[model samples]
Target: MQIQDLPYPDPGVPDARSGPRFLVWLGRNQLGGQLKALVWGLLHFLSVSALPFCVGFAVQAVVDRSGARLALAGGLLALCGFGIALGDTMLHRAAVTNWITAAARVQQLLARRTALLGSALTRRVAAGEIVAVSTGDVEKIGWFVEAVSRFTAAAVTVVLVCVALVVYQPALGVVVAVGLPVLALSVLPLLPRATRRADFQREKAGRATELASDTVAGLRVLRGIGGEELFLDRYRRASQEVRHAAVRSARMWALIHAIQVFLPGLLLIVVVWQGVHLAREGRITVGEMVTVYSAVMILTYPLRHFTEIAMAYSFSRPSARRAARVLSLERATDGEGSREALVPTGDLYDPATGLLAPEGRLTAVVCGDPDAAGELAERLGGHTAESSELPSALVGGVPLDELPLDFARRAVLVQDKDPVLLSGTLRELLDVPSSGDVSPAEALSAAQCGDVLDALVQGSLDADDPMDARITERGRSLSGGQRQRLALARSLVTAPGVLVLDEPTSAVDSHTEARIADGIRSLRQGRTTVVFTSSPLLLDHADRVVLVHEGEVAAVGVHRELLHSDVRYRAVVTRETDDEAAEQELNQLQELEEIEETA
Candidate 1:
């Protein structure tokens, strides 16, 4: 495929059986491109292989003192030159096209998988591993794929040259043919050791990459805790380990290279010695001996490709395996069939925790464990894995999982505790695909993001409109409270039928959070809204509060009623007992009396 035809409409499902199997699958998928590369490679290698014969003929003509034959030899040499030039150029073009197209196809598959898997992709694979696979690993796989054609052409050329040599002079041809195989096979014994070292190097490099990614991701936190040096030192050691492993692997490859050179040189010496003996015995003409010797020398180039192809395979095998592992991860669903949209007019019910977020009401969930609360929030929005044993979340009493993923997501929006803000302008960030009933201004006001807009306006001198102001990656330039509010505003703009928010106001102060809680309730008056929080300010504003203890719903009632009746609820929401409250109140009164007496 051409570069312009990129981002294939369907990258198509990969085999993902094993590393070698994946390579085979890639080759199968790009048969036309492979064939093009093979044809070009054959033409190129054939041109190269024909050169020794031209030289042999030229030498024969010179010995015979035939001007006509010499002129013919010159013409053949010119033709070979033209063939070499055209074949080399086109061969490179074809090989590079195959490499690029293969890489692009794999990249598209990765992109599709990432989109399909969403947040679960990160959970299953390390961020650095994913990065490495997409970047370096893809290139390695492409290298092997591109090498296949060239290796095939080289092998064929070697065989043809050997046969021609045998026809010209049997004794010299047999010696060269037998020795060529020895030179190629001698490196086989060293390959296992080299492969082991390469695998070790790859592992170390992956670890180093992972460490660097994690360190960079948490750089702000590391600096806050004054632990940058600790992390830096850890990264340093990891990088050193990677370097040492690479050096060891290089050493093994170097030995293999030495063997490749030494064996071929020995083979050339044997061929020359044999040819000299034949020439002395008058069994072969001087020109024929020269041809056999030149042919054997030319065979060296193709024979070296055997070792090169071996190296390419050795390096690419693990990379392909890693890529296959990533591509093999399937979503826990059928992920096919009709995607009928859900009717946006029902209570969100999770059978796992027996928690029901009723229609047109604000339901607050207070779980002792934040993680359980997050998971429950996800389930309520129908984001649970299809493989989960828990029953599907119900919307309007219909199974959420039974509906298509796109439909389910549209029907229920779940804003995670740590929501990400993609880099874009304020307007772009709020432009989500949904019912555009909620204006950006209204959503921003409800989310208490007025200050965020003002900050953006103040930061960008060229921005005539605050909505046009740019946001940095992950909203890193903004404070925690501003980022949280901005994310909430973006979510609100979607205006989904059911909104499940997990600790949406966790980072904000009490006054700002109180405003957000009240604003959300007012804005979503006739919509289903579930807030997973333990904050008293937000819980008190909810129509109904459900307390989740362990993994099940422990209590359900108004926030005030729970505070008065359930000690566990009080402990979580208020984090104080009645005795402590009384003690604090008495101490305040005593302090007031002491102040009056002093006055």
Candidate 2:
């Protein structure tokens, strides 16, 4: 693929059977670019190899006192210089293109895989591991990919240079040619040790990254529980382990580099020594001695590529493996059933919990077990695993798991308890693939986020419009309630056929909660909406409230009726045990509602 044609329309199905296979697949797909790079690399290294011949011819011309031949040699030297310059420049360009394109392709594939798996991807892979794979690992993979062509060129140049030296003067040439292979192969014994150290360092670094991610994600909670220093100390230990491992890894590579430097220098010294003896004995010309000496020095340049390619492979192998592992993960619903968009808008039925939110109505589910509630919420949106042991939820008459993922998501949008707000402008955040039924203004008004808009404008440095103002990553700049309200507004803007919200207003005060409850009921009129919450404010607005006890629907009725009728429902909703006190609270809330209605 050309550099300009980056971000391929489709990266194609990857061979994720193994890390090595994946890397091979990447190279195969970019064979054209690799070949282009290889050709340039050949041109560049071949030009470099020709330089010593030009110098040897010039020296011979000088000794023979032939000015014409000397001038010809000068011309050849200039030509070779031009070739070296041209080839080197183009070779670098081609190699960098290959690197960037290869990295872009991998990123696109990873992004596609991420989209397919959604939240489940993180459940399977650690957040930090995923981060490392996408960032550092991708670069390493690209490094190896780009290094291949140059290494091939370098190897070919070494072989050609060795043969030419032998043909010119067999005595000195044979020794130099034989010694080159030994020099190249000498570092092989040290590679395994270096690779092991590198792997150890990579492991330590990955652990440290994972620890830091976990610590930052829960920084707020950590401070609340006074565990910041404990995590800090743990991270410090991990960081030190990473440092020590890196030092060990560096030491091994240092030895390899020393060997590379020392062996090449040794071979150079031997070649010069033998060439001088051949000159003294009149077995080889002085010009030949010069040629042999210069060629040996020139050959050392290509030899360095040997160690470089080794280093590239050593680092890239593990990176490719990590990327392969992530790509290999399949969504739980993948290949479970038909891949057709056959879902119809209707009631959401979770067979596992026997909970049904009827069509075109607001249904609130109160589950004492928060975990069970969250699971049920996920099931309603076809987020179940492929395991047949866990039954798929249904919509209309068809099982949600049987429908296509895109269709299921479009049909039902589930807002998690702690829904995330990604960084963007208010306009961008609300810019979803909506049904066009709800305008941003209407949704914002319904979500009671006027204050959120004001906050955005107030926080901005230049932009007066909240929609133009930038939101920080994860909306860290906003209050929890603000984030929740904005998320709710975004969900409302989508105007999905069925909207499922789990404790969407948990962070907001009761005053805002009651208004949000009214907003949800009003905006979602004639649409199927399922809310998993125990807040009486929200429950009271639901057309039907289902109380879930022991993972099953225990009771179903209007909120006020269930409050007085079912003891478990009352206990779960109000968190009150005394019937008298529960009624008293309910009465007070009823009075407030009446007064608001009168106002």
Candidate 3:
């Protein structure tokens, strides 16, 4: 497709077996644009090559004392100049279009891969590396794609010029023809060194980017713990390492450039020296000598493209490889499983943990170990680390892994303990793909975040509408409770078939938590909801409570029933040891005995 038809309706499946293969795939996909650029480039370079011949003819005409020949030569010269201008302009336009379109296509492909993988992408690949691939590496890949056409035109024009000179004047032509290839091959030995240095620099830069990202993401926590300075120092060292690697890379490229300049100058001297000797010996005339000298000078111009192509390949190779590495990652569920439509309206079960949450009920999971709870929550939502050894969580009788990714996502929505709120208008943040049954305002009230709505409306210039208020990235500007409550509202608005919430009200106070728990029961009535929490406030409101101990379901019953009947369950939910629980139980018994005596 042409550049105007860009943002390809589909970026197509990439052959990400290797970086070089990926780059080749990109070039093949954009062959139409590349050919367009090549055609324009040929016109431009051919016009330029013709200028030396026109000057040679003009000199010959002056020597012959023929005004007619002079006029003809001048006319041809002007016509060639106009062709050069037109060709150069169009060539640039075509090349740039190729560049932008290739970059856009790669970007679209990356976006699609990211969508398919979701948070798993970052888990498998570094956030920094992904960022580098999408931002800097994308441009490098485009540069190589665009350079191919121009390099082709330059090489073809160089060959044509060498042949024309051989036909017109073989004695000096043979020398140039042989020397041109030598000049082009001179930088081959240094290319590997340059490429290695560039790779190292890219790696260091990626690490520095990752470090900076992590530091910023945890800046608030770091300050509270007084460790920001330590991270800053570490980042400074990373930046220095990046700088040193860059300088080394630049040195190698600089040396290659120096050879590019020095070798061409040497070739020009040899051609001019031989031409002068021929002129003095009467083997060739004065005009012929000038023509040969000017031709060599013009030949140096196209020869420079040889080094440019080398540099482009060197830079883009590593970038394409990194992009390929990222695209090669597959989601945990991306297997050869049937994507048949499955309308699962029964209980959600995790066979690995033997945990079951019945349909049309609010089930509260009490896990004292936060990490285990998090892992269980992920399983309940059909998410786990890349391993596929364990059977996937099932909805009804169908495995979530067998269902299509989009359908599974719609079927179960999981809000982790730390739910993130992205930067946007309040309205935009809540406008997720949802069932459309729950309004944003109703969700907000259900989340007990009415105060958050008030704060946004008052802080915003558009005071009349809280929905218009903008949130900073990760809702960093708001308090922890505000961000948590806002994220809860957004999740409630989704109104999924099964909602898995992990400590959804951990950041809020007891009173607020109680209201949120009641709201959740009211809003999610007659729907399956699994909440992983130890808070008595939320567990007290659950239709049924399941206790998980040591990665297995230990007990399941009503909240009060489990609290009184199972000592382990009571210890977990109450955040106490069995000894402490018994001591408290004994104190209660003694108080009852004294009350009976007083009565």
Candidate 4:
């Protein structure tokens, strides 16, 4: 009944545990509700089991021709009918209530896992995959949970009906009992192959969804490079492959469908043919023969569900597996030590690079490999920047892994170059994490986004309210420079102890980037700031620059000192810069790289 009992046990996962086993665990945990629904469902089945016997009684009463007895039998039949209707409605309602609560618990588990993982969710799994799990897979798993009760009900109904018929008329009852099972079990032979095909189809569908999501997320970049047509062609080919996979799955299901429909019909024929012989031999009364016939006819209804429940179960398994896998990913390391012990009021250090960002000081990292620089920035933030399995950095005197998660997160904030902007007005977007004390105006002024704010209504809450214009997803409505600036502004507002920025102004023009660089250093005075940029203007603002060569720090000094001394650093930072004054200073470093290469 509690939220903790849901299926999701891990945050980032592709669990290999079979779906059936998982369901058994859930059922065990919620045994009370499961038992309640099971009882009600059985009662419903028994009420239905009374129907065939009632029909036989009415017929036998007519044959006997005793008016009083006939009236009594008819009244009994009516009473049975009322019981059936009432039991059926109540059982259905109880089963449905059980399912809703079961599903709610699962949802709560998934939600809790999401919160535990935070932004790390996207690193471990695709956004589309998460979307699919929460929307489609959750529903299917819930459906499977509810169907368990219905299946149980149908099974009980069949068993009780078989026992009743055997007691009433041995010869005809034997046929009814045996024939019904054959109808129910017939679909079993086809289920595995059908389910295998369905699994393949589901995998392909997930792939297509992930691909579409990736394409949409990077649509702007693709559009910029003139490769939209090429990407579209590849996506079209993938789409066609998915279509073929779907077709194969559908054909298998079709075969299963055909078998389920025809098998019961065969069983019905056999039961009826045998019953006629028993009646002719006077082994059973005419009314008893009618009862046997009615039982056989009604058995098919539950037997049909036996096939259907199997099919639903087969379809639901793959979806549950998909959801479970996504839910099972290991969370990034969070230290369990005392919060105060992990709290950093000092420097950040990376052993891998042999670099230390001394406390409350501006530090810049310039690397020939931009990726290494970005990654270094992320580890220093106390989390993996992306989904790689790299070791993290130490903050103050302790390894980040030894710090309490909430404290580590609060102490270090990583501001990626392409920071996401959710749909909201400029002011609301600026106030990420939505604190009551921080003013939007102060954040904008710090981000140097006054012009952006003016362009948006002075303080309007909307394109609707005039102060808050909703940005399109990822701030698609804003230019790249504007988005970068807004993201910087948002981070500045937080004012965490360590601000790690990777290529903060990579997308902006020289002039805008220069102003941004100028504004950032002044605003972030007396803070431990790491800017991972090759931009000369931005590099100039750093109090000290550490040149990362390959995966290590090649050199460390002021921007001018590194430019004069480190050639590899020069070749990178000088790229696409128009800082006319630093030309001689830049080329000197480039010449050193050429000399080093020749040597």
Best by TM-score: 3
Model 1 C-alpha RMSD to native? 5.1
Against the unseen true structure, what C-alpha lDDT does each candidate score?
A: 0.85, 0.88, 0.88, 0.73
Q: Is candidate 3 or candidate 4 better by TM-score?
A: 3
Q: What TM-score quantifies how close candidate 1 is to the native fold?
A: 0.93
Off by over 4 Å in 1: 337-344, 385-387, 577-599
Q: Report model 3's TM-score to 2 decimal places.
A: 0.95
Residue 320, candidate 3: Cα error in Å is: 1.4
Query: Judged by lDDT relative to the true structure, which candidate is superior, 1 or 3?
Result: 3
Q: How much is 311 displaced in model 4, in angstroms?
A: 2.1
Tens-digit per-residue lDDT, 357-460, candidate 4: 78878888888776677667767877654355667787777777667776777778888766888876665766555323435555566566756655556434
Best of the two (2, 3) by TM-score: 3
RMSD of 2: 5.5
Give the lowest summed-lDDT range of ten residues in model 1: 333-342
Give the winner by lDDT: 1 or 2: 2
| Tens digit per residue, CA lDDT, model 2, 1-599 | 78788779999999998889999999999899899988988888988999898899999989999999999999999998888899899999999999999999999999999988877677689989998899999999999999999999999999988899889889988998899999999989899989888888888888898899878877877988999999999999999999999999899999999998898899888988888888899998888889888888888888889988988988888889899999998867744358555548778888888888899999999998898888788888878754536788788867877777788788889998877777878888999998999999889988999899999999999888878988887887888899999999999999999999999999999999999999999999999999999998898899999998997889999999988777788788878768766676678789989999999
lDDT for model 4, please: 0.73
| TM-scores vs. true structure, each candidate | 0.93, 0.93, 0.95, 0.87
lDDT (C-alpha) at residue 256 in model 3? 91
lDDT of 3 by residue, 290-349 (tens): 777788788778788887888888889989999999888887884444767655678999
